[model samples]
Target chain A: LAKTTQPISMDSYEGQEVNITCSHNNIATNDYITWYQQFPSQGPRFIIQGYKTKVTNEVASLFIPADRKSSTLSLPRVSLSDTAVYYCLVPNAGGTSYGKLTFGQGTILTVHP
Target chain B: EPEVTQTPSHQVTQMGQEVILRCVPISNHLYFYWYRQILGQKVEFLVSFYNNEISEKSEIFDDQFSVERPDGSNFTLKIRSTKLEDSAMYFCASSERSGLAGYNEQFFGPGTRLTVL
Candidate 1:
């Protein structure tokens, strides 16, 4: 699995846009970038996923550049409730590996008022 | 949205005793997994189950630990003899699988916090 490095923490004010970037310098072709958001006392939830370029969902957007070395997760109009730990994951390559995630020390996002 | 559910949201056990953590994954998902996070540490993978057998496991899942899908509806992890270090939050996850792609979005359950004394 490609190792991932992300900021330890970030801060944002309400109604501001927040962008968190994760670098996976050793990423392989078969690796896909997926993000998960985890709130206190709750399980991590899927936010968005992308192989390349840009993919957006109702909750967030993921942008992957051509080099595939790093990806950014963009959250629009953040609110205090958006404060949580965000994780970036790249699965190990195999035929039968169905989402066996190796989690890193996720980036903690604190949304301020 | 369909979600994974786990039993006994918190379990407190004595060291050297046995304990079991149970989970019911999303109804239609085929793959099951176990992960744990020590206090203030990153979540770590334990094991993955598919076709009623373990497909992969990490070094942390030593001989003292075992996983079983005893029946259709439940998956359980049993620790033969718990140690103090075994205390952590255990999370169960499941995902649907198909084709040659080795990945799927896994849905996690609210973890069971195991406290060993």
Candidate 2:
């Protein structure tokens, strides 16, 4: 499994864009970067995922560099309800250890009015 | 949207007693998983089940913990003897498939908060 590092916390204002970066220096070639969002007392929700380059969805966008060592989750025009803890995971999606998600101390994004 | 659902949103149990956490995953999902999060801590994987058997488990899932898909729709996690450390929010997740190249997005339930006293 690859280890990931992210900012402990981030502050954003309503209608502003927020970007959370994750560092996975040891990520494998086949590893795909997946992001999840969790509000207080709720389960984590899938946000976006990408292997390389940029992948955009209605909720968020993921940008992966050529090296695949790091990825960024960009949330556009954030709102107060968008405040949550965001996790960047590299799941063991294949082989004997398939579909086990290893979550880290994710970045807590606090949206201010 | 078809989402995973868990029963007994909150459970309070005494130490040395048995407790069962139940979940009903999305009807079409094939892979099931259990994870827990201690207050102010990161989420930790406990176990994963597929094909009526366990596919993988973490060290946190000890002998006291067991998983069963006793019926077509229900998946349960049983703790024979609960301890104080067992207190946490247990989450159930499921996915339609596995593998990096395929659709492996795991959808999680709201979670069951278990408190041991």
Candidate 3:
């Protein structure tokens, strides 16, 4: 499995946008970039995933550059309820990879009301 | 909007006691897995089960830890002898079948919090 690195913490104000980036220089050629948002005391929830370029969803957007070495998770108009730990996984959403989710120390997003 | 469900949301067991954590995966899913998260720590995979057998397991899953799909609807994790260090929130997840016969995008349940005292 490919390893991922991301910021440990990020601060954002309500109504502001927040972006967390992750680096996986050794990403496999078939690897996809996936992001999960986990609330305190709950399971990690699926956010968005992408192989390259950009992918958007109702909750967040994933921006992957041409290199595929890194990806960004963008949350728009953040709210205090959005405060949670976000994890960026290397190409690991529903494939032959199975559930080998080696979670990194996720980025804790603190939103000030 | 189907979801996986677990029984006994909270279990309090004494050290060296036997405990079983139960989970029911999504009906159509073909894969089952167990994961645990100690307090204030990241979730760790315990084991993955497919084709009525274990496909992979972590170091944490020792001989004391065993899993069984006793029936079509129930998947269980049994810890032969509980320890204080085993106190954690255990989660059950299931996923559809992937092309290579591996699990697909896994959906998790609320989790069963086991407190080993």
Q: Of the candidates shown, which would achieve the greatest TM-score relative to the real structure? A: 2
lDDT of 3: 0.85
Q: Provide the lowest-lDDT 10-residue window in model 2 chain A.
A: A90-99
- Candidate 2 lDDT tens digits, B1-117: 899999899999999999999999999989999999998899999999999999889999999999999999999999999999999999999999865462447899999999999
Q: List the residue pairs that clash in candidate 3.
A: A32-A91
Report residue A98 deviation for candidate 2 (angstroms). 1.5
Give fnat (model 3): 0.27
Off by over 4 Å in 2: B100-104
Model 1 per-residue lDDT tens digits across residues A1-109? 7899999999999999999999999998888898999888777888988889999999999999999999999999999999999999987655556567888999999
**Candidate 3, residue A9: CA error in Å?**
0.8
CAPRI accuracy category, model 1 = medium
Tens digits of lDDT, candidate 3, A14-83: 9999999999998877776778778877777768767889989899998999998899999999999999
lDDT of 3 by residue, B1-117 (tens): 989999889999999999999999999888888989998898898998988999878899999999999999999999999999999999998877641332225678889999998
TM-score of each model, in listed order: 0.96, 0.97, 0.93
Each model's C-alpha lDDT?
Answer: 0.90, 0.92, 0.85
Decide which is better by lDDT, 1 or 2: 2
> In angstroms, what RMSD does candidate 1 have relative to the true structure?
1.4
